[model samples]
Target: MSGLPTVDDVRAARERLAPYVRRTPTYAHDAIAFKLELLQVTGSFKVRGAFNAVLQLPPEQHARGVVAVSAGNHGLAVAHVGKTLGIRATVAMPESAPARTVERMRADGAEVMLLPTVAEAFALAEERRAQGQTLIHPYDDPRVMAGQGTIGFELLEDVPDLETLVISVGGGGLIAGIATVVKALRPRVRIYGVETAGADTMRQALDAGEPVTLPAITSIATTLGAPYVSPATFDAAQRLLEDVFVVSDAQAIEGMLAAQEALSVLPEPAAACGYAAVLAGLVPRPHRGTLAILLCGGNVSIDDLVRWRSTLTV
Candidate 1:
């Protein structure tokens, strides 16, 4: 409960969240199996953690309400969960967060406050917590990580012969949860994490042998732009993750476009980072079996997509 979530913890979370979230589907193309988590209820896998964390709160705590800080997807998830459970929710997001993301959170009935930066959003959330609101951290909480681990549970069940799992790392919650479960269940399955070059918090943490905050992060994949990795997530990644790689923003955009064209799904840059690593040959090709690439989110606006697509060179 304190450190990395166990397989049992993930299993329990899966059962706890069975009614609220979707199982999501997996499909194979070429040698890579795509876990289409973008199809998830809130347009991202964060809903798994959001629902799990919110539901675990006592009724009185729920009445007290919840507060969270997110670049985008986590905010939307928390907002959606709060609306579903009839809890008051407030989300602090950066001013630079995509307009569509802000609109979605507002549409879900959360009081959205736009701060100067993601760091400021976290500070605001902490302040709100001091005022008695239940704080739902984006990635640092064990319960949230346990909820995210449910994705690994589904992956293993859907593809029993899965040889490798490529996941995009933000604050490391998603990969940490998944790696803990996958390593425990299938020790031979290699767990790899991907990050955009400028926002590689996990890679930086692994290199430093501890978590460190960056002065700034700049990536088109705003969802992957955590300033630092949490101690719990760092420990889990160090012990359980096989390797971590980084992809350029250009590569991520290319992967996004490719996924849209081939898979008929528009993946946000963070979601496409892992697939970008594969496409760029940063990850070795699996010779004997299949690899699974987690297409984690799809929350881009058409205008943003058009702008990104226009950047592609001939």
Candidate 2:
């Protein structure tokens, strides 16, 4: 629980989470194998970590309830987990988050607190934590990272001779979790990360050799717009990833549209970032083995899509 999660932790997380979460499928589209995590319960892979974290909490802590801060998907996952486990949940989310996601969290009976920015939302959640509610960090906790690592287990089992993996990096939780497992199982497999231009938290962290906070979160991919990556995630990114690629918001939108056409499921701009990198040829074409991209979430609404599309011309 203190250090970075081990492969054993991730394996245990998979078993512990088996009954509670869905094992989302993998699909082949063109040359890229897509891990359809958007089909996960609460519309993202965050639920895996959310469930793992909450389930491991002591009974006394569960009674005290849990609080979280997220752009959207992590809040939704925590809200859904709280509802299922009969625990009171509170989420402080940025006002810029998708309206539909906010509504869904409220529908799950979680207290939804909207702040002007993600940093302010984190502040609110910390205040609530000081008041005794357990803070379920979106990306910083090892338990959550181990939970997210479950995806790596599935990917190796599903993709035949997978050579390269691409994932969108936010606070670095998803990539860290998956990379831990992938590198442990197949050390030769090349693991890569993607970020939108303005929301390049991991890319910046890797460059500076430490976590660096951005001045603003300006990307259309709000889910990938964490202002800074944590030290734990930064360590993982530095040690495990082959490279981190930065792409434009327009390219992410194009990838989202491509996913919509190919898989018939519209991915959120953040989710499409990995695919966007691949499509833009930022991730080299796999010459020997399969290249897989994670389509991580699908929590966008029509209004959200329209707003995101505007980024193209902006």
In lDDT terms, which candidate is top?
Answer: 2
Q: Tens digit of lDDT per residue, candidate 2, span 10-82?
A: 9999999999999999999887799999999988999999999999999999999999998788899999999
TM-score of each: 0.96, 0.96
Give the alpha-carbon lDDT of every model: 0.89, 0.90
- Model 1 / residue 310 / CA error / Å: 3.4
Question: For candidate 1, lDDT tens digit of each residue in 1-314?
Answer: 34677788889999999999999999988768999999999899999998988999999899889999987889999999999999999999889887878888899999999998777888999899999899888898888999999999899998889898899999999998998899998998888999998899999989999999977887888889888999999998888888999988889988998898879999999999898899888887776767999999998877877887687541
**Candidate 2 at residue 112, lDDT?**
96
Segments in model 1 whose C-alpha atoms lie over 4 Å from true places: 311-314
Per-prediction CA RMSD (Å): 1.4, 1.4
